[model samples]
Each structure stands twice: as structure tokens, then as C-alpha cells.
Target: MPARSSSRLSPANSRIESMTVAACGGLATPAIETAIRIRLPASSASNTRFIKRSFEAVEPPLTLDEPGRMLMGMIVRPLRVYVSPVFRRIGLMLLAAVVTLASPALPAGGQDAPATPEVAVTDRVAPVWDGTYRRIRVPILMYHYVSPLPENADEYRRELTISPDTFRAHLEYLFFEGFTPISLYDLDEALLTGRELPAKPVVLTFDDGYIDHYTHVFPLLKQYGFTGTFFIITGRVDARDPNYVSWEQVGEMAAAGMDMEPHTKNHVSLQGRDYDFLVYEMLGSIESIKAHTGRQPHLFSYPVGQYDADTLAVARTLPIWRAVTTANGRYHTTDNRLEMPRVRITGGMSAPALASVLRGD
Candidate 1:
């Protein structure tokens, strides 16, 4: 294509530009014109004097094939009009007009794409920094397979596979020590809304929807009256994978107060993938989980605890309120929701060792 003449009004940052949208849905030319017409101060003198030069230059009839065709040049090139001050805020207005004009004329979806509503520019929402609240010490304990590894399993399997007895010990120690196990959803709600958390709030998360979660993890959670978070590869559930949880078991666990979350449709690192694949992995998984469980999960666990900026952006674009990665630490309100960290529990870590990690030592 002709290098897609591109621009955008960073209404949030006070910048603007426009372009010929690629094939599909986008901000159409008329919509851009309308946004500019509405935002410009509606004085006739201002429109006649300042806004005319920029708008006349970009009003579509002579879309030059050359990319980056400067607006000043476009006006002067054909009509040979001397560019003069069009308004008091000519500089910012011109930049905005240019960016909006250069922005792809449709949403990437197609002409059928819904036009984005034009709203007054506003300041961006400042991030919730770590010091925004008294930071809570909530350790998100991450686990995978709870079954004992087969004899002579490799180191990766060995580290990921903690025995059922060890799992029980970890829960038992937590139960005795007055650690209240909360679901990821509960922690997320408290962290985001400043709600009260349990006295010793900690999260127990299982990845890959392994059957051990139903067999080994769920019963322990019920025994201790603890709520846990389970991240399932939606595609793997009820697939007769032999080691994964069935939809019926997953529903049962959710009924028992476990936070059921998407681990993506298939278990894979969702880094460096295209937008479609990201949509498939992120939105598709959410839909699949909702179809099975009837409730939409608010949290997602990055498959294998892996993600990138693109993946995080996609997670936020959807209904998922937050996401988790493999980085280990106690979560604070200021933590990045999508790239939030977790403390991994592996084979051979006794109850005392886990307590040390949880105590923020």
C-alpha cells in the first residue's frame, strides 16, 4: 500500500493528525472532519481566517500519492495560497488536524466498524503508584501439576511437579498459621477498589487446569475453607487430555469459591504474536470460559507466566480486569495489573520456606 498516510489526535496527550485508513473499519474521512469541526472554536472569523488553510489543505479532494505530504505544502502546491495564522491556537490545532486527517479512515475492522465517539480531550488517568495506599503483603503462590513426577523425570518437570503430600503440608501450615487463602478475584477486587482484605490474605493459583487442581488442590482448599485461583487453558478443558480438569469439575470448583481464570485458549507463550492471534488467545479464551462456566472471569494468567506489552494491552482491551505473570513478589496496589508477579511453589519447598516467602522476608 501507499505507506498508509497516518496520524492521530492524542486527545489524552494533546496531539493530532489524520490519514487514509487501510482496507477495513477505521475513523472515516467525514468523521475526522466532524471531530475537527466540532473541536474548533466556532467563531466565523476564526473559521474564515485560521481554520480554513489547514482544513482546505486536507479536505480529501487531492489526496497526494506521496506519504507524509505536508499540509502547508499541500495547500500552497495546488492553489498557491499563502499560509497565514488561522486561529489563536493555530499550531496545536494544525497538528491535531493533520494527525486526524492522516489517521486511517476506518477502524481496522472495515467500513462496518463503529465510529469512535468524539469526546472532549481529557488528561490521562495517572497510574496507581505503590505508595498510593498502605501496601498489603499478599503472596500469590503459583503452582502447576500437583502430582508426583514419574521416576527419572527431567529437571523442568521435577521443579514444576510438587507431590500431593507436600501440597497438603503447605496448606496445613498456612491453615495453622492463620493465613487466609483468597482467590485472585478477591485480591484484585480489594487491591483495585480499596476494599478490606483478609488479615493474612494470600492467593493460591494453579495453572493449566490440571486435574490435580480438582483432585489434590480443591479438596485441600475446601478442608481449610480457603478460596483459590485456577488458571485453565480453556481449550484443554474437557478435551480428554487425561491430565487436565473436566468442565464438570471446573464448574464444581468455581461453585466452591475458586476463581476460575483464562490461561489462554491453548497453553502457549502469548508474546510477539499478531493482533488476530492475540485476540484469539485472549478474547476467545474468555468467551470459551464464559460458555462453559456462565460467568466471565475477570482475571487471566499468562500461559507459562509469559507475556509482552502487546499481550498486556490486549488483556486490558477485553473484559479481563487484570492478568498475572511468573515474577515473584507480594502484590501491592501499585503493581502493574496485567504483568503482576507471583511466587512460584515448586517441588521440595517445605512449609517453613513458604512461610518465609509469604512473611515478606
Candidate 2:
């Protein structure tokens, strides 16, 4: 077989040839002539000038006896004369054909077609509760404050509150959209068995044991039939500060199915603390939760999600099954439960944006 010519063909030219061939009933010669005439530049500067003039002249057409061949010859003669041999040998006719056929398929504005919608295709394909290896994991998200005020606000005056309307919209979206709020126990079981979570399984979590968690957020969660995890600062439980939730409020939330996990005795960063100090902070809070509510928490959320290898080591030594971290990224089964990642919800998170995050977008 003869080696194919290595001339590059433009999409535009290929389309033109296709259209010409279709119009001329699959005959190659006339299509080739039409392609060459359309693609090749006019011969000489004078010929170029004349061709431009001819188009502008707008004269009546002359009838020719040998219309087909004569018209083809007239159209292609200047192209053969003008185009350089290098371009001709490279099959400019092929290039022209591609262009013509492709032009009409393009939008009138010469833009590409709108992009196709993407379907989320995953390798894992099993029901979340099936206890199979192919199941996907659901992430439990946590939030502390959703204040519109800047972080630089005076520590005393800053509010840890999101507006009622925004909170309501968030709750409404979760309910209407069928997001099943699960417990930490459910999450652990899924991880252990490789079970898929519900299609829209998301756990809502709040930290700091804020009074607002009871007064403002709790009613909303209750109204929406959703459950959340609340990690309290053990030392601040009944402090005089109006911000901290009282023991009574914490008890109510726990009774209502919210997990009141430990966030350390003091809200101190435990990363660089000594072993003794770390143990006290970790164990003291766990004991406090048991003493106050009669429920020992197995989960511990790091204060500010700030912990080092030493802190992590201490966490592992303790009876805690999971230690939530401030790291960003969607969770997977292979992720370390002790250093489990949680998406931080804030005032800036819109419904669509939150949906995207929940969907692991």
C-alpha cells in the first residue's frame, strides 16, 4: 500500500469537502475543485485585487454552454496558479473540504456547542447499608460560629450567631432534599462493615457548647428532624459567661439525641502540651461529660482541630474511638477515624454551595 500523505487536514477544510461532495453526489473531482478554489489564495497581487473587485462589481451572471466543467475550471484555475507548490502538495484541497463541511455545524456566532452535563460515575456501586466494599462514605460536618462580624472583632462583643432566616433555609433544604442525618455510631458501623451510606447522608455537628446551640440551632434541627453532634468545652459548661451553655441545656440536647462529645477541659491548644497536661485535658473532659450527663463520650473533637503527632499519640492512648480534625477534604473509608475530617460550615456557605459540599463536589 502507498504511504498516506502526511499533510495535516484542518477540521474546517474537511467539512467543506464533505458539503461539496454531498452537493456533487460523491464525485471527488468537483469537490476537490470547490475546496481548492475556496481555500487557495488568488494568484499574484493583481489577481487578488481583481478577485476582490469582481465580488464587489455585482454584475449579472453569464450563461455558459459547458456549465459544470467550465464553472469548475474557472473557480479552481486561479487557486492552482496562485497557491505555492508546498501548500498544494500538502493537499490544501483536503483542508478546504474539512473547513466547508464544518462551518455550518458551528454556531452562527462561531462558538463551541454548550458543554454536556456531567453524570457522577463512581467505581463503587452498592447500597450504603449493604456492608459491601463498593459502598461510598458519608461525611459528618461541624460548625462553631457563623457570625457575619469579622474575626478581628473585640473578643467580648463578637456574636457566635447566624441569622434565623439563614439557619431556617439551611434546615429546610436538608429536609426537603431528603438528607438523612445519622449518628456517630452509625458512621462507625458503616466504616467497619464497608456499608454504603444513604444517598444523601450528612451529619450536622456544632461545637463550643454555645447557649445559642440550644436557644437558636436546636429548635431548627428539631423542626427539620435532623440530628447533630455538639462538642462542649467541659470547663466552661456553667461559667458566668453568657456564651457558654448551662448543664441543663447540655442535658436537654443529649436527651434530644445530640451527641455532647469532649472539646477538652479548657479550650487550650493541646498540640505542644506535655503528656501529663494532655492526659488531664483529655481524661478530665471525658469524666466531666460522664459525671454531668451520665453518658461517656467516645468521640473527641480537637480544640480548633489543632494537634501534633504527640497530641495524636495521646489521643490514641485514650479510650476515644475518633478524634475529628480541622483538615479539609472529603472523607473516604480509608481515612483515619481518629483524624477524621469535617467540613466547616460558616456564614458564607450558601444552600447550593452547601449542597455541593454535601455531595462531595
Candidate 3:
């Protein structure tokens, strides 16, 4: 390749480059102001610099596409003058600048960055991000029981239970395909601090504290080295209900690093409940959970995915972080935190069906 031209950087381009550099270098605001005032008058980011140093930077034996693109870049550069972005957006602008600087010349396939070949790995979950989605799609997966159902089980039992074998396959598929399981707290912290989450994040949630959770789900979660959220019905806990788990099991799961959010005091639907009912369901659950687990529950799932507008309003009043609903869609950071949707996993959901769900299809 011939040496790049030594022409001076355009005043506009230079100012932009300087600002990007300054931001990355953690430069003082006064220096940036000095550059804006003295180094770059408002007029300088206009017509004169449009045939900017980018064109000059291009060597002469140009392709038919080069001049057109140069002209396009030059035109867009001036439009930045009219756009006054906030300071927070400056980091994003810096990223764009970095990309531009790093790959000034396109790769052989016309991509700015080299095309990475997909390498198959038996144990790795294949990454799926293509940088095209408008919103981050994370599937908050809901499960109830993960025990082997008998051949003569009832409809509700079958609908609410996933076979342990199928559950393990699901976990295997997730692990092989590279989905990172996270908790509601992780999502909350990310929303608050603008922290980046894994490219493919899937939250495993088991509703209604079942003995099967301690027997099958918890062990499977541990086997896969994954995390999950277990929603407990505080009234059923430690009451010797054969179906529901004990407080010792709940405490063990929490100590083992699983998230334990509240379901309700008695697992009642909150769709049209009064203020007193709502308080008992939400606050009562919190107090009961604290009494048993030594830590107050901070997140919740609506019992049977039932909640109305009034119930949601009451939920907002609770000290809990947020609540989840049974509506079937993926979770995005921008989605309503109070009414987040989840994909329910049930018996005999094939790997392909689960894959489609993960893909937000």
C-alpha cells in the first residue's frame, strides 16, 4: 500500500478527533472549550471543510466508489454542527470514531472489520448477536416444576412440569449456545448503572416453591453451573406441604447463591384485589420471607401471571425492585420494569422450539 497522504487534517475533522481523543484521554472540560472556541469556530464545521481532509487523505488512483463515499462522509460531517448531543452520548461518538480510525480501509469482503468464521464447539453456546436488533432481547424464562411426570398425570401437572431429562437438555443447549443466565438483580443493576450485559442473557425462573425445585431444578442448575430465581409462596413454606418446599430448602438455595424473590403470602392472584389485599400479598410476603431466610425478598412474580393496572400501581408502592408478568415476549432494558414479560417453559418443549424462543421469534 502506498503511504497515506500527509495533508493536514481538516479543521472540523481535527476538532472532532481532538474531542474524541480528549474524552478517551479524560481531558479537562476547559481544554475542550478552548478547542471549540479558538480552534473551531462554529462556521469552520461547514461548507469549506466539506471537501475535507478525508478526500485529501485518499490517494489519487481512486475506485469509482471512493469519491462518492468521500463526498457523503464530508456532507454528513457538517450536519454534526447542527446536532448538539448530550455528554453521555459523547462516549458512543467516541466508539464510532474509534471504529473509523481502527479500520480506515475496508476488509477484503467489504466489511469494516474482518469477517470471523464461525467455529463449531461442542460445549460452547454459539453467539447470536448481529448488531441489527433495535432492542436487546433477553428471554426471562419461567419454569414451575422439573420432575418426571407419570404417564397418567393430569393436564395441569403436565403443563406445569418439565421432565428432568428435557430440562437438562435445555440447559445443555443454553450452555452450548452461549447464553449467560442472570438474575433480576443483575438486570436491575445494569439498568441503573448502564453496565453491559452478556450478548445473550437468559434468566431461568421457577415459580411457586415446589419440592421438585429442591430435588431436580436446583441440582440441575448447579450441574450446569448456572443461576436461577426461585419465587416462593411464603404461606406454603415450612408448613409441611408435601408439594411445596420447606424453609430449610429455600434457605439452602439462597445460601447456594440462587435468587429468592417473593411470590405472595398465599399465592393469590392480584388482578382486582383491594389495597389491603395488595399490601398483604406484597408486604406480607416480604415480611414472611425475611423471617425465614434472614433476607427480605426484593423481586416478585405475579401469582399465575395475574395483575391489573391497579395491582401494578400497588406493586410500584412496594419496596421490591420490580415484578414480572406471564406475557410471552423477551425482556429488553427499555421494557417496563414493573411489567416485564417472560417465556414459560413447559413439558416437551423441543430444543428447536426453545431455540426459537431464545431468538425472539
Best prediction by TM-score: 1
Q: How well is each residue in 249-352 modelled by candidate 3, as lDDT tens digits?
A: 88799878888778986688887765445654665565445544556467889999998776765565555665788988875543366778899887678778
Mind giving the per-residue lDDT tens digits that candidate 2 earns over 110-218? 3443322222221212223333433245667777664345567665334334555667777788888988988776676677565456767877778888777887888
lDDT for each residue of candidate 1 in 88-201, tens digit (9 for 90 to 100): 123333333343334333322334433233323222232232334445668888988888778888998888888888888998998888888876666666665566877887
Q: lDDT, candidate 1, residue 6?
A: 22
Error (Å) of candidate 3 at residue 237 is: 1.1
lDDT of the structure predicted as candidate 1: 0.59
TM-score of each: 0.63, 0.58, 0.61
Mark the 10 consecutive residues where model 3 has the least summed lDDT: 25-34
Ten-residue segment with the worst summed lDDT in candidate 1?
18-27
Quality of model 3 by C-alpha lDDT: 0.61
Cα deviation in Å at residue 313, candidate 3? 2.0
Q: What is model 3's C-alpha RMSD? A: 23.7
The lDDT for every candidate, in the order shown, is 0.59, 0.57, 0.61
- Provide the lowest-lDDT 10-residue window in model 2: 22-31
